[model samples]
Target: HPQNPKPQNWTVALEKYYLSTMYSLEFIIGALGNIIVVFGYVFCLKKWKSGNIYLFNLSISDLLFLCTLPNLVNSYSKDQWAESTLCHSNRFLLHANLYSSVLFLMVISIDRYMLMKHPFRDHVLQKRNTAVVVSVAVWIGVILELLPLLYFLEPVTAANNYKCLDYASSGDPVTSLVYSMFLTVFGFLIPLLTMGCFYLKMVCFLQNRSEQIRSALTLEKPLTLVILTVVTFSLLFTPYHVMRNVRIASRIPALNISGGTQRVITTVYIITRPFAFLNSAINPVFYFLMGDHFREMLMAKTRQLLGRLTTTGK
Candidate 1:
């Protein structure tokens, strides 16, 4: 990569080192958090409950996504894509994780709508193959959608003196801008809209039918707050994403980010991305484990583990 007239400040090796450290932490966080979600869902929540199916699917996606993080950590930490083809593929894996998470969230929201509004819907109430099929199909579609990144996102040398990521090495500046826009809108925005709309429908339906609220509110207060938090999260993520792409496109000197203020505009990329990924791990404790049945299952599992520890004399 040749240097543009305006240079980025960081050195490549130093930036790689910093990214390596951050990725190490990210891997650990994702591993432990998503594993907990996966284990709890599989061992305890596998039975068909009103919402557990959606949650279990979400956990599965997160778990599958987390499984690839070590390769990512290795990519930067080892300071070479020489480690394995796996390391080269880690960025695509992460992108697939993003898509998987979005797809599962949509499933959850649609499930919520059905269970709340049309409680007798066979798809919502009974054990069915559609959800499982849909989840698998969704991952397949996401992989295909992200296939181009695999072609373009080689371990390219960075102009910023780092092995950081960018879109295709060859294309119009506006091409990346368009891809980023698509990623933001389809990957983040539309699913978020789906979440918001269906959750709103669920809330309205619940509030209308005194029976559902009476049953749920009695058993779940802080539990209900989990959904509320998710709704709030969706609302907040949209603008951050739009600004992210706008700032990314503006990173091109030709886009004119405020006459030598490109750095500040581009800073949103660094600032907001961690917040988004961190959200994936944040919901486990409050959303699933804190629900009544789930809380009981978690405590039961915790006690069982402690008991095993005592028995093993470790």
Candidate 2:
């Protein structure tokens, strides 16, 4: 008798359960947090700075991505009846929101850097119109970059069930590898480097300025925001990318990795994957923590909502 094919124990039942729970929690918290942030920026805030524009766009991206979590959770939990079209659209929106969020964060970092390092050029480069144009460009670029996935990422049968957004099951392995490489490099690495450089320059500028001048410049808020952005990217995005590459590398036949190792990689990916989505929820916390104005606006809105509820009850 032929040796039983290595028992495929990659059931991931526990992982799926955790993912479903986490996705549900993320959707509720992320949607509410991002909605508050968007409302604060759009209606409560009197003035819109360049950074505020980027934050608003980021909030929209988070909200849009959070909107898709239910479908994603369903895919993880139930039989995937999602067609190829829905799968492609979900994949596109997921990546589009992710890269666009990174781009907007980079924009915010650059805006803050310029405000501190080259205050003289503020009139030309730091205008609200400039930020709006850049934001539009980012949206277009992310959409175009991910458009190919619609063609390549088709629904495929896995474990006798149809699955959507399962790139590994459907796409050309080489193409998947290339796309992951591009995403990690351009989407993660480059932006990370750029942010680091901008922050370094800002620190240098602060170092050169006199205490009185530095005190007057009052860059603590912007600096805090930069730190939060870096932390968010590091904690959420970094592990996902690293594990993704490792999983891709494990697929190579030359590596001759044991079945057990592959299983471990898959488990790690499942665990770390949701973290990328957590970024959407955590960002609103950052906004509330870092922005006094945002907090005040949120409190005022909460009070108004309570007043209306009490009046309605009476």
Candidate 3:
């Protein structure tokens, strides 16, 4: 490609150290938080709210996604995956987490709206069975949506068979750009907009209700979820999607984008990859903040364990 006449050596060096550090930190922190939440839900909490089911699924997604990061960390640190199978599977897990996280957040937003609409909890959608069915549908939908990635994402690059290149970076630029855009629009933009709409409706609903409802302390969790979703989309997803398209577009032979410009785009795209995955690390915060029952249960469990330890020490 004339646009990228020479390899940008600095990008590789940056990715090697930067992504290794980032993924290592994310894996450790994300795994701990998600694991604790999963255990807390399973062992500590007896009663399950409709929202609890959704948050539990979210925790599962984060935990599974975090599991894949060790492979990524090893690959990035060594500059190659041990095998192509590892490459493909890890990439699959990564994309699955990304799309699934946003979709679950959208569902949570809708769930919040339903909660406010039916504080008495009589709505059909608020039923525990319905939540389970919806969660199942979300997993299946995310799987079907991401199925093409397995085919399109060539695990190894032609230039370096050992290096597992992402679809946008390794495949035919025109084709990669098309598929990336498709994923962005359907997997990200639609869900993000859906979340925004529901959040707005939630805010309106809260405001229009009586002052009793307004002062009921229900605003904190929903508002926190909304702010977190917005922040995650803006800080993490947007730049990655934008720079991915830009990076692939620069690689297309017909575009004739300058070599210098291509380097800048590629560097930025590499940077965004780690930031995008930061969601896995940060998602555990939602479990603590949004689930009142969860927080109380987890704290009680911790206190109980501490009391046991103190008695043992005595």
Candidate 4:
């Protein structure tokens, strides 16, 4: 008889260990950072800039994503499966935050681009009410996109343990493929393209202006911020989306994937999946590092809190 191949038990163990460690770190960093950002925007800042409104909403979305991390960490670390409702609900919240964060970031990029490229129209377009309306629309749109997950994510029992949102438990391959395609395209690709176009346009606009004009407007720092935001978004999100499509493609019967190939895909998916969650933690860092106005407010809030604490101690 031909020699039988062995399963990659070590690889699976390593992947699980990696996920458990990183998800916990991501949860701590993302939860604390997003809370501070959201609180600062709501309570510390006296007035909200149009862009701050969007950032506030983004932080809330991140916080919501972080809220799901403990359950995820528990599931991955303990290798314990979740109940059906919990599983589908967690998946729904994850996707909702993922897409909403992308959309809000896109909105911010557009807001910055318009500020740089069409300064004259800022008053008409950049308003608090407008941001509120857009934020509402974004929430509604994300909910609609992810609502199907609740219906489709059936519960399963494997090895005498119940599992929710199991890939093997998915109802129909055709339905999964269609839904995954829609998510990959609209959720990731389109928003990515939009942000890219705006960043490119803003860069071109800045380069065309004379040095004196650029300095007078103080465009360099903000331009750098834009570049950083675009780079960060690409770094964190691209892998997840690419590997997601790969996983979906592997499920097709025509592909006739080998066990080893499936193992490779599974490992890659496991690694990249957290990158989506990592986005939540990173956005607050970007705001602190690159956002001048936000940084100042954060500092002011910190000093004020410290002073009050010192007084209370006295």
Q: TM-score winner among the candidates?
A: 3
Tens digit of lDDT per residue, candidate 1, span 55-101?
Answer: 66666666666666565557556554443245346666666766777
- By lDDT, the better pick of 1 and 3 is 3
Q: Which digits, one per residue and each the tens of the lDDT, describe model 3 over residues 1-314?
A: 43443464576677789888998999999998889999999999898988899999998998888988888787877776666787888889899999888888888888887877887789999999999999999999999988878877665645564688876676788887888899999998998888888878877766775477645576656766786777777688998889988888999999899878878888888889988888888888888877547788899999999999999999
lDDT at residue 110 of model 1 (Cα atoms) = 68
For each of the candidates, give the backbone clash count: 3, 0, 0, 0
lDDT of each: 0.60, 0.76, 0.83, 0.77
Preferred candidate (lDDT higher): 1 or 4: 4
**Steric clash pairs (candidate 1):** 11-161, 12-161, 12-162
lDDT score, candidate 4:
0.77
* Candidate that beats the other on TM-score, 2 or 4, i.e. the better one: 4
Tens-digit lDDT track for model 2 on 1-314?
A: 02323333234464458888888999999998898888788778887767677788899999889888899888877745576677777777877778888887887788878877665545666788988898888888888877776665766556435656444434565667788888889888899889988888777777777576656468766777788788778789998888877777777777798877877786787788788778888878767755437788778978998999999999
**Pairs that clash in candidate 2:** none
Candidate 1 lDDT score at position 225: 54
Question: What's the lDDT for candidate 2?
Answer: 0.76
List the candidates' TM-scores in order.
0.76, 0.88, 0.93, 0.90
A best-first ranking of the candidates according to their TM-score comes to: 3, 4, 2, 1
Q: Give the poorly placed runs of model 3, Cα more than 4 Å off.
A: 1-7, 213-217
Residue 69 shift from truth in candidate 1, angstroms? 4.0
